[model samples]
Target: MDIFTGPKLRDFKNSPPHLQFNKYVLTGYRPISTYRDCLQSLFYLHNEFGNIYTHGIPFICFLLVLPLSIPWAEIEWWIGVVHYLACLSPTICSVFYHLFMNHEGGAPIYDTLLCFDMFGVCLVNTLGALPIVHITLLCYPSSRLVATLAYLLLSGYGVHCAVSAQSNVHRLQSFAWQAIFRFFLFMLRLTGAGRGSPASLRLYLTMDTLALLGGLVNISRLPERFSPGRFDYWFNSHQIMHIMVVLSIVYLHWGTLEDLTWLKGYHCPGE
Candidate 1:
């Protein structure tokens, strides 16, 4: 199936300068193609095929199967909705960005796709943590509202920084504020100063840790840097980051589910 066959891919130097963000991925760069051609690339082998499929498969799974796993009837309606979207957002944007990155329109198209990709990540970080705030500050209504509002404001800055950033390092830096805010919430749960599923703290930690590591890995260009060109089509740093991003989202979902379940049986001091 030349569904598996295609035009010979270019080396990193041969690929567009903008798309050569990772010099270590020295070959298999897709040629600039029409949107339809990009769509067709889905069936072929390329460096980004793995990136596209890694997120693509998870996006579909979350869209179709996550609802069954979620305690929709038991959890707050909006929480379920937000969580669902948060779980799905990054992948939806990432698949499109990675697939069409080599669009015939060139760097402008790539930049736009990159912005959209960043926005998706911002959405996941912002939307995913709102419910955690609500649950953690459940007892203190005033504080809950304040914390949620503050976190949202912080995330707004994150989105701005992320979408407008000039480099990968800056892009990852944009998420630091949001991550710090989440760490505070995690501390609350840890110290019993706030409330949540105690079991979830570990999951949340794993989530953040994997996400941070993924970002660093992308920036540092690990295994790929060790052997330029060998990992051009598979196991490249960016691909590894994509996989880690999915795993982080999974942990986010697991931790959220634990909190929702605990919320059902628990109450605040005043309640």
Candidate 2:
């Protein structure tokens, strides 16, 4: 079971420059590794071990189980499809990024992986909200169409900002417009102009709150920063954020499912 038969690990300072992003994680950094060496890492313990499995296990579970829970046949098939992809994207993208971050290909590859990780988050941010938008404007056909198009346009710009952002805070900020847009929709739902299960609004609110908290925790680097090297292979800020991100996705799924099920009984006024 021990595939890490060779290639000793490095310290924080010894790791590749790009891999030194976290000073709090002062040890257990994987060295510049070939493709095979990266694969071998799965069997051994390292700083990224927790990161890899935290998202990796959920990715597999979501892949296998979400489709069964989804209303694929009962609802508009596209909504269910998008929901499924939205649930799975962040985890899979994260797994790859964490797994190969120390690759011999170096910073360019690391940056590409970082872009991919951000892309996954953007997918969830964009596609996950489509159903909410659709349901909110279900009665107002014209507004639904316009809002959907506008949201997609906003998401497109968000993706560009996120991928190009040079800092963590900027990448988090890139999502501000989309979050504001979603908040507007939630307000509409609250005011009864928008339609959805009453329970779903609270779930969506919790989803965003957890995600925002996770982002802030990552940017601020708490707990780990307070005691460097103590959490190198365990409950560090990034790992904590990863857990929060997963929880946030669960809420997104719950809220969307609540709305989707509620959809079966509701019709727009005047329709």
Q: Provide TM-scores for the models.
A: 0.97, 0.98
Best-matching candidate per TM-score: 2
Lowest summed lDDT window (length 10), candidate 2? 1-10
TM-score of candidate 1 on Cα atoms, chains taken together = 0.97
Candidate 1: regions farther than 4 A off: 1-3
Q: lDDT of all the models against the reference?
A: 0.92, 0.94
Error of 1 at 15 (Å): 1.5
Cα TM-score of candidate 2: 0.98
Over 73-171, each residue of candidate 2 has an lDDT whose tens digit, in order, gives 789989998999999999999999999999999999999999999999999999999999999888888999999999999999999999999999999
lDDT score, candidate 1, position 12: 80
What C-alpha lDDT, on a 0 to 100 scale, does residue 74 get in candidate 2?
84
In angstroms, give how far residue 17 of model 1 lies from its true place. Answer: 1.5
Predict model 2's lDDT versus the native. Answer: 0.94
